[model samples]
Target: MSTGKGPVGIITGALSGIGAATALEFARLGASLILADIETQSGDEMITKAAELGGTATVAECDVTDYAAVERLVARTTADLGRLDFLVANAGIAEQSRIASGDPARWARVVQTNLLGTMHCVRAALPVMRRQGEGHVLIVGSTSGREPYVGEPSYLASKYGVVGFAYALRMECAEYGVRATVVEPGTVDTPLTRRPPAVRALLEQMHPLAPEDVARALVFTYQQPPHVVISELVIRPLDEAVNADMPDAEPR
Candidate 1:
């Protein structure tokens, strides 16, 4: 798993939640990090934490919805770090609304951030990985992508799109030594998931998966031999049903 030189990678949505946890885990592994997020204050805090962990890290104020911004992020990371080793397309958001009653704008935003945003990161990073002839791309997906849920049509669509994209990207990148993987985690306890009281309560009862749990999974995927590619991984907390009844719950 050791790269003679420290591994360098970019993680989108690194300000908090799974993204932040992944950055910290990479730091502990002695990886050079490019943490990208739109939130300036939180991004700075993460940068400080990465430094405290003795890991080299820089913050990129990036909005994944902006392809140009994502391009610059990849360019800056490679220009400064000397190599691009991994890309984690983890920038995502969720809204609670039904297709029949949901806000059109909100649904669109979800699609843009979760689906289009991931595509932008992949498009930006694939070239660098191809050039290097070795790289890993981890797309943070959700259980909703694999199974249908009750609410949040947009979020579901977006995640489903991510899963589909990962599969296609993996095939396309196979010849170039770039591994594409989709890590689907279920009911992770994070600020994003805690917003809904009912959903949060249900997750708490299920002993929901922590952000670190998913982060560790990412690290494992990255640490594997270059010749081995884990195409898709679905992780969930024990005793937690994949798509439990959530009559009142919304998408996340």
Candidate 2:
């Protein structure tokens, strides 16, 4: 759990965007990486990138929402790396729904992946962190956790849950020398964003932050001294303001 113990760091959704970038950044810092994702092609690329960076990288195709698979991921990481130092629960999804004609399926999928999947990762990874007596948990959340968006009901709900869970877990792990923190990013440019042009622009107008911006915050929080605990952060894009223009832009 202490710094420079094992080169092992576990990261999910590590094939693209912030997850991939964070993995490479950690490798650059001399940390061996274990990157997991559902996409084999992307995972392979990440593994290759880490290798090029002179850091060991292991890629596993894992769906965090799957309990058994996640369990295997933890077991494999421990088996291969000898010990686990950091657990980054970064896998998530986004979806929209309305009260009148709500897409139950989308809501369920988003909630399960973004919210329930996070719980699964934390639940499975806690035992190792507890045993190590020192570890860090970084969960990728969103500003929607605190500020609501009318169309993104499910995504907001899931992030809100994540923020709450991260704070609560931080308190629980303080005694064990393990820390939990949530990174609340706003309007990141990623595959998770699927909306009309106007809608996307409206969201940007509301508030926006890139995935790397959030990743920078994540690394900043994790790199802090052990005594310091950054419980929560809200990273917003400078381009996006709290603008309420373009009334006919889209219906929330």
Off-target runs (Cα >4 Å) in candidate 1 are 1-4, 247-252
Residue-level lDDT tens digits of model 1 in 29-108: 77888889888687767877887876777888999999999999898887877789899999999977667678999988
TM-score for all models, in order of appearance: 0.94, 0.89
lDDT tens digits by residue: candidate 2, 166-210: 888988988999988888876677665634565566665555555
lDDT minimum window of 10 residues, candidate 1: 243-252
Taken over the whole model, the C-alpha lDDT of each candidate is 0.87, 0.77
Candidate 2 has its poorest 10 consecutive residues by lDDT at 242-251
Q: Which candidate ranks first by lDDT, i.e. highest?
A: 1
The collision pairs in model 2 are: 208-237
